[model samples]
Target: MIRFIITRLLNGVVLLFAVATIAFFLLYWGAGDIARQILGASASQETVDLKAEQLGLNEPVFSRYGEWLSNAIHGDLGASWFTNQPVTEAITSRMGVTLSIVIGTVILTAIVATILGVSAARYGGWRDRTLQVVSILGLAIPGFLIAIFLVRIFAIELGWLNATGYIDFTDSFTGWLKSVTLPIIALSIGAMAAVAQQVRGAVKDAMRQDWVRTLRSRGISENRVVYKHVLRNASGPALAILALQFVGLLGGAVIVEKVFAIPGIGQISVTATTQGDLPIVMGIVVFTAALVVVINLSIDLLLGFVNPKVRLS
Candidate 1:
């Protein structure tokens, strides 16, 4: 287990390094005279040059990348080029809100997907076919459109929830719940559809295995055999899908944040990208890459712990 974990961590580190390298160079080469853009066209040549120097744009691109990467290794992500706010600080401030939504979506998806999947597998009738149809539709529709529908129905028409804006949990727990509920649901629908299908397939496959019959023959109760042995075997794959869903949610959260008016990492990401705020943008890129690595590592570790073959390998 220890060896497995260590190997996974090393792999994650390599992946993070690769992502940071690509993100850094792409932002650097593609951005095109950020200082000039910041200073505007009317600014004189000398002033533009000074602005470039101040922003470190005049430095060799490779040298700047080296400095940035080195500082990042030492836990110094630098400051926002526009606001001059520390990159880490800026991200952390809104990180919680984004995480809260994503986490809620995960939990909701897990519970609902499990129920639907297990049921569809067990019943295997009209319910199974019906679920397949709905799941396909759920997967096909974009998350933002669903969010908009939710906003129109729940927030505007019914006035049951807030259409836009965020509330801090510290300020009011109820308000915060109301604020995040729609976003979480919007994200969860697609995930639920996808995961439920995986779970259903896994469960059905497990039920068909000879081990299930062997257990039943040995006098194990039906429910116990199905829930304990069958579900356990089914869990491994569903868990992997869940991790992938987490990554998807992060991407989707950007649009969800804008539609819902939540000041999360996603919101800041949009603003930073629009303004060519490279420090903030780079910081976010690194943060996202790190987030993905950590989540994937955790899942791999979980799988290793759950399955002896994986750990032994």
Candidate 2:
């Protein structure tokens, strides 16, 4: 188990490096004259040139990439070209808001998805078919569209909650939850549908196994047979999907955040891209990549506990 964990951790590190390299080059390729964007058209040519040099934009791509990587490793994500503040500080300040939304979405999605999944799997008739159709519809709709619809219905029309901005959970937990609730619901809708389908399928498959038949033949109570013998055996795949979806929720929350006007890492990334804020963009990318890598590693460890067979392999 220790060896397996170490191997997974190493693989996660490699994946994060690949993610960073790809994000860095992609941003570098798409962006144009960061200094010029920051200074605007009215800035003097000499001033722009000096700013560019200071930012290492005048250097070769390889050299700049190396410097960026080194600084990132040292916890210095460099200074934002637009805000002129340390990238780490800027991202850290906003990290709490993003984390709150992501965590809330994951929890809500998991609970709702599991209930619906178990219900559909156990019932497996008209109810199952109805849920399947609803899941398909959910999969078809984009998260941003759902966010917009939710904002319109709950925020604008009914005025049940605030539509924009965020409150710190520490300062006012109730207000923070109220503000983020709609966005969380929007982000979790698709995830719930997807997760429920996966869980239902897994449960159905587990129910067909010889052990389940054996339990049924022994005259075990149907409830015990389903919950203990079936659902427990089927949980491996559902748990794995849950872990992955939770990780994905971070990036998925971006569109939802924008729709609801909540400030988060996704919002910060969008702003940085529009303003050509290289440091901020890079910081967000690296931070998100690291988060995904860590989540993946944690999932791997969890799988070992969830199914000892996986660890044996």
Candidate 3:
């Protein structure tokens, strides 16, 4: 298990390095002149040149990449060229909103998927078919489309919630919950579909195991046996799917954040990319990659703990 964990960590490091390298060069070559963008097209040639020199844009590409990589390794992501705020500080300030939505979406997905999946497995018939149909529709619809539809129904037509806004949890937990509810539901739909399908398969398979038969033969209560024993083992695959869904959520948040007008890393990423704010864009990318790695690692550790067979492998 220790060796497996070490190998995964090393692989994550390598993946992060590759992601950073590719993103750095892509931003550098494709983003045009960062200094010029910051200074505007009307800025004099001399001024642009001075700004470029100050930002080390005049240096060799490799040398600049090395410096940036080193700084990132040391937790100094540098300042945004446009905002003049440290990239870390900017991301940190907006992280609360992003995290709130992500966490809420995950929790909602888990609860909905587990209930729907287990119920479908336990009661096969119209219930199972109906759940399958809903899952397909959920998967078929794009998250942004869901966001728009939800905003229309819940906020525009129903007027139950704000169309687009965010509130800090510190100010009012109730306000924060109300503000984030739509976005969370929007983000959760696709994930819930994917997770429910996987859980249904896992639960059905688990129920067929010999141990499950043994428990049933002993006259154990179906609910206790299913929930306490079957679901615990069945959860391995579900947890793995959840991790992948989380990565998707991060990417999906880019569109969802814009639709909901939430100030988050995703919104910042779009703005920084458009304006060629290299530091901020790079910071968001690296941060996202690192998060992906950490989540996957945690899932691996969890799998190993829950299923001893995985530790042997």
Candidate 4:
């Protein structure tokens, strides 16, 4: 297991390097004259040129990439051009908000999906049909639309919660949770639906396996046969899908954050892009890429533990 973990960690490092390289070149290539964008339209040509030179934009892409990569390795993600704050500091400051929402939604999704999926699979008929309809509705609705509707009903009409902005958890845990509740629900809807479908499918497949048939034939209770035998076997695939979804939830939270006005990495990224803050944008991209790599590696390691055959392979 240690050997496998080390191997995966090394692979994650390589993957992150590749991602950083691609992000560097792509941002430089796509964002032409980043200095001008940063300096603004009214700035003189000479001033813009000087600013570009200051930012090292005049250097070859490969050279700049090497410098950025080297600094990043040392935990220096550079300073934001607009805020003049360390990129890491800025991201870390807002990490709590994003982490809270992501963790809450993921937990909620897992519980809701598991219960609904198992129930539907066990009682396959009207209950299954009802769950299918609900899942379909979840998939069809857009998160932003849900956020809007939630804001209207809960924040505007009923006045139960604050509709805009974020409150610090340390300041008021209740307020923080209340404020983010709608956004979390909105973000979780699609994930819950997808996970439910995956779990239902996996459970159904597991129930048809020969082991399940034998267990049933041996006069094992139906609940034990389904939950203990079938669901346990079915959990591997469901867990894999859930892990992937957890990573995806990070990306999806960005849009939900924007709709609900939560100050997080996603909101910061969006703001930096609109303001043409190249440093912050690159920092965000690198950070997000690193997160994805880490999540993937963790999932791979988890799979090994969940299925020893995978470890042997």
Candidate with the greatest lDDT versus the true structure: 1
Q: State the lDDT of candidate 1 residue by residue for 1-313, as single tens digits.
A: 5786798789889988999999899999777888888878999999989988987888888999999999999999999878889999999999999999999999999999998999899888987998899899999999999999999999999988889999999999999989999999999999999999999999999999998999999999988987888887888889999999999999999999999999999999999999899999889888888899899888877776765556655
Error of 1 at 169 (Å): 1.8
Per-residue alpha-carbon lDDT of candidate 4 for residues 1-313, written as tens digits (9 for 90 to 100): 6776788788878887887788778887666787788878999999999988998889888898889888988999999877789989998888778988988898899899988899898789998998899999998998889888999999999999889899988899889988888888888898899899888988988887888889889999999987776776777777778888877888888888998889998899888888878778888777777777777777677666755656744
TM-score of each model, in listed order: 0.96, 0.93, 0.94, 0.93
Candidate 1 stretches greater than 4 Å from native: 305-313
lDDT for each residue of candidate 3 in 1-313, tens digit (9 for 90 to 100): 6787799899999999999999999887666677888999899999999999998898888898999988988999999998789999999888778988998999999999999999999888997999889999999999999999999999999998878889899999888888999999999999999999998999999999999999999999999988988888888999999999999998888899999999988899889888888999888888889889999999888877776656655
Candidate 2 lands at a TM-score of 0.93
- Cα lDDT, model 1, residue 305: 70
Residue 54, candidate 4: Cα error in Å is 0.8
Instruction: Give the CA lDDT, 0 to 100, for residue 34 in model 4.
Output: 74
Q: How many backbone clashes can be found in candidate 3?
A: 0
Clashing pairs in 4: none
User: Which regions in candidate 2 have their CA more than 4 angstroms from the true location?
Assistant: none
Minimal lDDT window, size 10, model 3: 304-313
Error of 1 at 168 (Å): 1.6
- Alpha-carbon lDDT, every model: 0.91, 0.83, 0.90, 0.84
Q: Tell me which residue pairs clash in candidate 2.
A: none
Which residue runs does candidate 4 get wrong by more than 4 Å?
217-219, 303-313
